[model samples]
Every structure is written in C-alpha cells, then in structure tokens.
Target chain A: MSLLSLRDQLRSGSVTPSGLLDDLAGKIVSRDPEIGAYLSHDLAAAKAEAASVDLSLPLGGIPIAIKDNMNVLGQPCTCGSKFLSENYTSPYDATVIRKLRAAGAIPFGRLNMDEFAMGSATENSALQITRNPHDLDRIPGGSSGGSAAAVASGTAFAALGSDTGGSIRQPASHCGIVGLKPSYGRVSRFGLVAFASSLDQIGPMTQTVEDAALLLGAIAGYDPQDSTSLDRPVPDYLATLNDGVKGLKIGLPKEYFGDGIDPGVRELVMAAANKLAAAGAELVEISLPHTEYAVATYYVIAPAEASSNLSRFDGIRYGHRAANPADLLDLYRRSREEGFGPEVKRRIILGTYVLSSGYHDAYYTKAQKVRTLIRRDFETAFETVDAVLSPVAPSTARKLGESAHDPLREYLSDIFTLAANLAGNCAISVPCGKVGQLPVGVQILGPHFGEAKLLQIAKAVEG
Target chain B: MSKPHIDVRYVANLARLELNEAEVAEFQGQLDAILGYVETISLLDVSGIEPTAYPSPVFDRMRDDEPHESLPLAAVLQNAPDQAQNQIRVPKVVADA
Candidate 1:
C-alpha cells in the first residue's frame, strides 16, 4: 500500500505496527533474494520495538527501511562495502532512527548501497546489486538503490535514504517512486556513516509526494550532535502538502533538455510540466548557464571531501582489518585492500590525488570556486520561478550491465540531479510517466529550505 | 586534454588494492575514461568565486564533550572478524616504513 493510504489505515487501527512489520518481513522473505534490498534484518528486535510503539503518533507503526549507511543500533552498518562487513555495530540509533522509533515507526531492516556510498549505480555493492522492481533486468539506481527498490516494491511504507549527489532521488526516479533530498541542513546526519560529509543529508523515499512529506516531518529537526544541522525551525511538511500549485512559477532549464538527455525521458518530463500547467501552474523557460559544469564540479568537490572522510577507515580503530600482517603498513594496506570495493578504491585514489599537496590548489581549490558559480546559477533561476523542473536522470534506468563497462557512463547518470545537490537546495523526484515501459522521473527543485514548497508543487503534479 | 595513460599497477598501489594483472588492465581503461570526463571540470571559468564548501552557511554545532552511554562490549564485538579485550584486532603495519 502507498504510505499515505497505509497511514489512513494505521490511524483507523485497521493495521497495527506489528501487522505492518509482519507484512514487511513476509515481503522481504519472498522478494529480497532476487532484489537484495536488505543487508541485515532484526525481526525479533523489530517486533519487540513495534510491539511497544505508542499508536497515537502520526507515523503510528508505519514500517520504514533505513539505508545501511545510517546507524540503527544493534544492526550492522556495512555501507555496502566488504571492508565493513564484520567490524561495526552501531552503538546507538542514529538521530533519524531515534526519531522514527519515537514516532511509532518500525525500523524493519538495513538496505544495501554503493560501498561507502561511492558509486552512482548499486553494482559496486560488495553484497549484491539491488534490481529495479519495475524490471528485474534493470538497475535500481544507487547508492540508495536498495531503499528505493524496497519502497517501490512495497517492502516498506517509506524508507530512509542518504543523498550525497543524487543517491536518493536518482534511484527513486528509476524505481517509479518519490524521493526527497532536503536542504543540506534540513535533516540531521548524526549517525550517518560519512561519505563526502559536506554533501550528505538523510531524506525519505516513498510511493507518493504526500508520503515523502509525512516521512520528512517525522525525521527532521535540529540535532546538536550533527554540526551541520540547521538550528532553524522545522516546518510541518505534511501540513503543507495540499497547498495548491496555482500561480506557482516553474522554471525549465534549457540546458537540462539538451542532446545527452534521451528524447523519450524528456518528453515524459515535459508532459509532467504540461500536467502541472493544466492544473494552473505557469511555466517559464529559464537557464542555469553553468549546468554543464555541475558534473565536473561535483566530481572534484565530492571526491576531495570523500578522501578526507574515508581516512578514518585505517586498520587501527574500527572496521575490517586484515589477518596476519607482516608489519603495520602491510596491515593498513591489506586491511584496506581487502575491505574497499573497486569503485570505493577508485574514488579514494582520485580524491587523494586531488587533495595531495601539489594538486590541491589546482583541482580541489578550483572545483570549489566553480561550485559557487553553479550555486549562483540556481539562485538566479529561483528568482524568476518558484521551483525548477527537470528530469531526474538523463534517461530511464539502464539494464544491469549496460553502463558497468564504462565508469564515466555510470557517473554521467547523475548529470541532471547533481546541480540541485551542489546548490544545497531541496529537491524531489516523482515518477512522471513511463518511457517504453521503463519509469522516468521528473524533478522539482527549490531554493534552500524550500522543501515544503517543493513537496507542495510535487503533490499538485502527483494529481 | 589528452587522457593520461594510467599505469594499472601504480593506480592499484595508490588505492591500496591488491588486484591481479588482469583486473589491473581492466581498471586501467575504466579509470582512464573516468578521469577523462572528470578533466572537463578544469575547463570551467570560476575566476573570482569563492569555493562553495558546506551547503549551508551555518557551522560548528558540536555537542558537549561529556560522555554518553557507550555500547555494551559484547554488542560492539558481535560482528568483528577478530577482536580481543573489547577492541578490534588487525595485522601489524611496520613494513611500509
């Protein structure tokens, strides 16, 4: 059932949290072997947790899947890398997980992802690549692929996902669901395993925009533990879901519709815009002139920071370590060698090279400067329109091995979604339509802290 | 920009990966292509703009230094491949020196 529909049933006592948990367990048991959405499940603890939930809360026992990168206490937080396969158990629930639990939501399991949230496709996962439920042969976008697939496949009412450059939205789009990457500071990252720490933010993925709003409301707030979390007042995302999109000016960036975007995906997104126009919203042709620079800038900035964040995985304190090393250096090398996947290793090298002494000023420093111009491009566009509309990916989900042979093709998958992230603005991807039976996503991007408006506009289009 | 000819062994060593020669050759081509696209970032004119680091302007919201409850030793070690006295165990590391 859609999370919103499930919420109605929950409020009326037709489905208990325990019942939802049972249903989720059954779904996982039946479908997960093929989809490989989950890395770990704690049914006994989940049931015990669900049994004690206070049903008066808005979430009221809704089943939620958490991305494996976020700590859920007593569960393994592998971050989809073999290096972390056996070394860590979250000492305590992440701030978001605690909030979900308090809201009477059941945290059913931890989902798979790109190792250390590095790759754009889930194929880099050391566990298993999560397949799109819409078509098993196609990839369920990543690194939040498992979360999106689980939600899209009805394994949970809604799932929590972390976005560092379109990890949440792209996969959600590919799976024919709704995914939100909130304003950078909107959601706390207290217990999220760091992956390009500056770019990571946790958000929700669900079947409908309204469900995304409901999930957002439950997990967003100020957290003293996360230095980047905003101290600003949290809005009632659900309360504003019905705000009509009448008179809302939506900007369509010409750069996003250019040659690389598939014609079919473009048509579907344009149709979504037309539907919004029919519902009384106005559309304006806008230009984010530096849109072409986003992929370039994102690669530099994300990797530079990732290099710094991943330094903690040394064989010293926590995580996997190699056995019977000849020396300390060998231990460090072998442990890391044994632990990280090909993509993770690739990023660490690229990141390290960029941040190293001689190249730092040339690559990392220069990329940061470009990031500002990219952000300004959005600021200028938002001034002319209430929200920006575009396709979430350049095309529909490619078949499982289609882009794997070429890593650049894989990185290009986030071309459309990265700009919203680089600007630190809130954006959501909703399934606009199908292109040749494959789902396509239309994105709604707004100014910083504009999640409520974005969700409102998304809901309008959802109808 | 002309693509750099990536040395598979060098790249793998830098990345701390123990790849066989076949894996190295395969990754050499993949890394070269990815780097080729990433090189496009250098073409942008970011002349005077300040680097956009964190998404929001707010910073330094750290928690107090007071200790919170720690996980039980057993729970922490439940998934460890090797452990001793509540700490994870790893191979020695002196050889690189």
Candidate 2:
C-alpha cells in the first residue's frame, strides 16, 4: 500500500501496525534474496515499537527503512563495510531516527549501501551488492542503493537515504521512485556515520513526491546536536505540494544539458520540462558557467572531509580490530586495511594526499575556491528562476561491472547532481518517465530551504 | 598547471592503511588520472573568491551548559573489539624508556 493510504488505514483501525510489519516481513523474505537490499532487520524490536504506536501522530504504524549509516539505538550500523559489520552497534538513535519514532513510525531494517557511502554503485559494499529492482543486472545507484532497491521492490514502504553527490536522487531515478535532498543544514546529521560532513544530507526515498514531502516534514528541523543544522522553521512541504507552478520560472543550466547525455534520457527530461511549461510554468535558459567545475571541486572537498571524519574508526573502540597487533600503529593499519574496501581506501588516499603538506595549498584551497564559484552560480541563477531542472543522472542505471575498474567514470556520472551539494541547495528526483525499459528522473533544484517551492514544482512535474 | 604525480607509498602511510605492491601500483595509476580530471578547476580565475566550507550559511549551534544523561557504559562499550572493567582496551601506545 502507498504510505498515505496506509496512514488512512491505520488511522481507521482497518490495518494494524503489526499486521503491516507481518506483510513487509513476508515480502522481504520472498524478494530480498534477489535484491539484497537489507543488511539486517530486527522485526521483534520493530514489533515492540509498533505495539504501542500512537495512531494520532503522522507516519503512525509505518515501517520506515533506515540506511546502514544512521545510528538507530541497538541496531547494527554496518555502513555496508566489514569494519563495523563484525561488532559495532548503535548506542543511540540518530536525530532523524529520533524524529521518526516521535512521529510514531517504527524503524524497521538496516538497508545495504556503498561501503561507508563512498561509491556510485552498491558494488562497493563489502557486505552485499544491492541490485536495481527494475533490472536485476543493472546497479541501483549508491550509496543509497539498498534504500532505493528495497522501496522499488515493495519490500519497504519508504526508506531514508543520505545524499552525498547523488546517492539518494540518482538511485531513486534508477528505481523509479522519489528522493529528496534537503538543503545542507536543513536536516540534522547527528549520529549519521559521516562520509563527508559538509556534503551529506539524509532524506527520504519513496514512491511519490507526497510521501517524500511527508517524510521530509517529520525529519527537517533544528537540532542542537548537529552544529550545522539550520535554525530556520521548516515550512509545510505538503501544504505547498499541490500548488501549481504558474508564473514560476525553472532554469535549465546549459552545462548540465551539454554533450554525453544519452539521447533517450535527454528526450524524457525535455518532455518533463514541456509538461511543466504546458501547466503554465515559464522555462528559462540560464548559464551556470561554473557547473563544469562542480565534480572536480566536490572530489577534493568531500574526500578531504571524509578523510578527517573516517579517521575516527581507528581500532580502539566499537569497530573491527586486528587480533594480536604488535603495536598501536600496526593495529590501526591492519584493522582499517582489513575493514575498508578499495573505493574507500582510494578516497582516503586521495583525500589525505590533497590535504597533505606541499599539495594542500594547490589542491584543497583551489577546490574550495572553485566551490565558492559553484555556489555563487546557483545564487545568481536563482535570482530570476524559482528552481532549476535537469536530468538526475547522465543516463539510466548502467549494467553491473560495466565501469567497475574506472572509478573516475562513475564519479563523472554524478555530474548533474553534485552541484546541489556543492551549493548547499534543496533538490529532488521525481520519476518522470522511462528510457527503454529503465526509469529516469527529472531533478528540480531550489534555493536553500526552498523545499516548499521545490516540492510545488516537483508535484507539477510528477503529474 | 602541470599534472601532479602522487607518492602512493607516502600517502598510504599517512592514511595509516597498509597496501601491498599490487594495490599500490594500481591505485597510483588510478589516483593520478582522477587528480588529472579534478585539476581542471585550476584553470578558473578564482583569485579574489573565498573558499566555501559549506554550501549554505550555518552557525555553530550552542546549548546551555547543563548536565545531561549519558549513554550507559555497557551500551557505549558493547561494540568494543576488546573491553574489560567497563573500559575499551587497545594496544599500548607508549613504551618505557
């Protein structure tokens, strides 16, 4: 059932919370082996929470799937890596998980992801590769691949996925679902295993824009636990969801629509723009001249941040450790070497190299300046346009192992989606149409904390 | 700007990750290519622009200095690879002179 319909049923007492759990449990048993979406799930614990769920609250009786990185008290937060898969368990709830529980939702499963949210595909997971539900041979885009796969396969009603360079939106596009990345600092990052502190934002993946809005509503707010979380009030996303985009101008940045986009994908996105235009929305052609620098800027900044953040997972407390180390340095080296997969190590090396002495001034400092230009580009574009629209990814989901050896190629696939994180704006992926048998999403980028207006246009495009 | 050559062994040591010869050679080649692509940004004239720490404007959130309940020691140490007497155990970092 859809999330809203399930809400209605639970409120009417027509569907018991535990009964919904039982249904999802059965679906997971049947489908999970094929998709490999779940890392682990504690049905007993969910039942315990569901047993006393308050139907009066929003998202009541709903079983929301969690990404592996978010800390939910007592659940295994493996982050799709072998390092934490052995022994680590969350000691406290993440701020988003806390908000979900307060909204009367039962957090259900630990879904698979790219190892420590590092890759463009779930293939980076040391635990398991979560396949795209639409085509089993193709990848569900990562690091939110498991959340996207679970929701796409109907094993999960809705799932929460964090976006750091298109992890959430790209996968949702591949799986024919909706994903939102709230403005940076719009949602609290407390207890989320930090991939890149500045780039990561946890948001929802679901079947519809309304459900995405509903889930975002429950989680977006100020929290003292996260130093970067915004103090602004979260306007009702659902309230403005149905508002048509009349007189609102949407910008199509020329750089994003440039060469290398698959012809079919471009056609679908243009059709979506036409749909918005037909519905009284004005389409504006704008130039974000610095768009080309986004990927390069993101690569330097995200990894530099990730190197610092991931250094916390040394062999000391609450993670995998090498047995019988001769010394402290040996223990730290072996534990991390054995725990982290290749993609993670590559980024760590790159991050460390960029921020290391001699190169720091040229690489890290230069990337940061380019990032400022990227942010200013969006700020300038939004002066005239209410939002920006483009293809969520260059194309639909690619077949598994196609570019496994070329990490740079995979990084390049994130071209359309990386700018939002670099600029710290709200963007969403709502499935617009299909390219061949694969699904494609049209991305809507709004100014920071402009989710109400973004969702308003998303609803129109979703139509 | 000239392409930068990465000292893979030195970088691995700094990152505290142990990599064999095969892994080092492979990653060295790959990292250089990635660095080559990311270096495209160096061509942009950003002389006067300030580097962005975050895309959005945010402040360091402050709270009252009040006592709060902490997680139980058992819960916090439950995932420790080695623990004893409610403390996480690790290899000795210091040596007797």
- Each candidate structure's TM-score, on Cα atoms with residue i matched to residue i, is 0.94, 0.99
Question: Distance from true position, residue A152, model 2, in Å?
Answer: 0.8
| lDDT over C-alpha atoms for residue A165 of model 1 | 92
Q: Name the candidate that leads on lDDT.
A: 2
The clash tally of candidate 1 reads: 10
Per-candidate DockQ vs. reference: 0.54, 0.86
Q: What is the lDDT of residue A118 in candidate 1?
A: 82
Ten consecutive residues with minimal summed lDDT in candidate 2 chain A?
Answer: A230-239
Which candidate has the top score in TM-score?
Answer: 2
Clash list (residue pairs), candidate 2: none
Runs with alpha carbons beyond 4 Å of true place in candidate 1: B1-20, B64-97
Taking the true A–B contacts (Cα pairs closer than 8 Å), what share appears in each candidate?
0.72, 0.93
**Chain A (alone) TM-scores for all candidate structures:** 0.98, 0.99
Taking the tens digit of each residue's C-alpha lDDT, what string does model 2 give over A342-461? Answer: 999999999999999998988999999998889999999999999999999998999999987798999999999999999999999999899877999999999999999998999998
